[model samples]
Target: MLIQILLILGFVLVFAITWRRFGQNVITFREASLWSFLWLSGVAFTLYPGLTERLASFFGVGRGVDLILYLAVAIQFFLIFKLFILNEQSERKITNLVEREALSHLNEDEPASANRPSNYESNG
Candidate 1:
């Protein structure tokens, strides 16, 4: 009973954070919805752990704990992959911005002297 209560409280906290993130536009509506669904599913599983056993059996897993562990590992890998993709996208955006800025400066009406090597570069 105590465990169930704690689980519910944890779900409530997650729900609150999800709502706040959505309200602040930190995440899209679709992401908020997905998070809410996941939290509710967690609450369901906590309230009825037997359901996991049944699910595990259906999936040919030996135990509920094993199934959960597998899921957690898969989720971790997926998140890591997503983070890698996002990092790549960010790098591309930054590179494009730098290139654009450099091109714009080249097109500006600067004197030839402005294009001279920097003092440090000349010294080197």
Candidate 2:
């Protein structure tokens, strides 16, 4: 009964994530990695009941492994959010660097081009 509920929720989460990740350019490998992880984790959580005993003993959880899994999922979500923030920050820095480089080259050329060789001259 309880397991069935968990299974349903797990499938729902996977479906939602799949739909969301569709038709988008994953600019960063982090996005791709996270998507894969979520889908895989959703499957694991859905199938957790069967491995409850094994995981329970492995983790030394007396009640069961469900709570541990729930905690793990929550932590994973937190980590994903952090990864997203870090990725955004990195992209912003890259954009700024590119813009600065473009401007620097433009400024350097205004005064330097007049004295530079006109590569367009023919050897005729």
Question: What lDDT does each candidate get?
Answer: 0.88, 0.67
Compared with the true structure, the alpha-carbon lDDT of candidate 2 equals 0.67
Q: List ranges where model 2 is wrong by over 4 Å.
A: 1-6, 9-23, 27-30, 66-70, 73-124
Where does the lowest 10-residue lDDT sum fall in candidate 2? 115-124
Alpha carbon lDDT of residue 107, candidate 1?
39
Model 1 lDDT tens row, 10-107: 99899999999999999999999998998998898998999999999999999987998999899899999999999999999998888777756753
TM-scores of the candidates are 0.76, 0.40
lDDT top scorer: 1
Instruction: Give residue 98's error in model 1 in angstroms.
Output: 2.5
After superposition, which runs of candidate 1 have C-alpha atoms over 4 Å from their true positions? 104-124
Backbone clash pairs for candidate 2 read none
Clashing pairs in 1: none
Q: How would you encode candidate 2's per-residue C-alpha lDDT over 42-72 as one tens digit per residue?
A: 5665566556566676777764566566768
